[model samples]
Target: MKLIETIPENFEVQIQKITGDNFLKEKLESLGLYKGIKIKIIKNNKVDPLLVKVDNRRVSISKGLGLKIFVELL
Candidate 1:
């Protein structure tokens, strides 16, 4: 598994685990991020906010939050 922030743009990955507090987990879940879900990295330049496609919705997330999301290549 690798941190979501490290994933290259245009790559699709499966969410494996999310490491953080309940509030953080809930926040991510509300944005359509959860374990077992597949997400496509739309932008991960390391300078701007990470953009990802989840369930057909495009969501932008901070790199800090992406650090807590573990994913595997799909």
Candidate 2:
């Protein structure tokens, strides 16, 4: 598994774990992010918010949040 922040753009991955508090987990879940969900990285330039597609919806997440999300390449 690797931090979502470190994955290259266009890579598809399945969420494995979220290393953060309940508030963070809840926040992510509200955005359609949760364990076992497949997400595709639309953009990851390292200088801008990460853009990801989840269940046909596009979501922009911060680098900090990305660091807390562990995923396996798909």
Candidate 3:
């Protein structure tokens, strides 16, 4: 699995884990980010803050948080 932040833009991957404190986990879940789900890194490509597509929704996540979310490419 690779850290979400390091994954290049326009790539798709399946979420394997979300690691952090309980508060971070809860926050991610509330945003529809959990394990065994597909997500795509948007290609419009803004560094620092990243944009990820979760289901039909596009969520913006910080680099710090993205680094904690791991995924395996499909």
- Is candidate 1 or 3 superior in lDDT? 1
Q: Note the residue pairs that clash in candidate 1.
A: none
lDDT of 1 by residue, 1-74 (tens): 99998889999999999998999899999988999999999998958999999988999988788889999999
lDDT of 3 by residue, 1-74 (tens): 88887778899999999998989888888999999989888842445588889988998888778878989998
TM-score of 3: 0.89
For candidate 2, write residues 7-55 as lDDT tens digits. 9989999999998889988999999999999999999995999999998
Q: Model 3 clash pairs?
A: none
- What TM-score would candidate 1 get against the native? 0.94
Error of 2 at 27 (Å): 0.9
Q: Candidate 2: what lDDT?
A: 0.94
The order of the candidates by TM-score, greatest first, is: 2, 1, 3
Off by over 4 Å in 2: none
**Which candidate tops lDDT?**
2
Off by over 4 Å in 3: 43-46
Backbone-clash count (model 1): 0
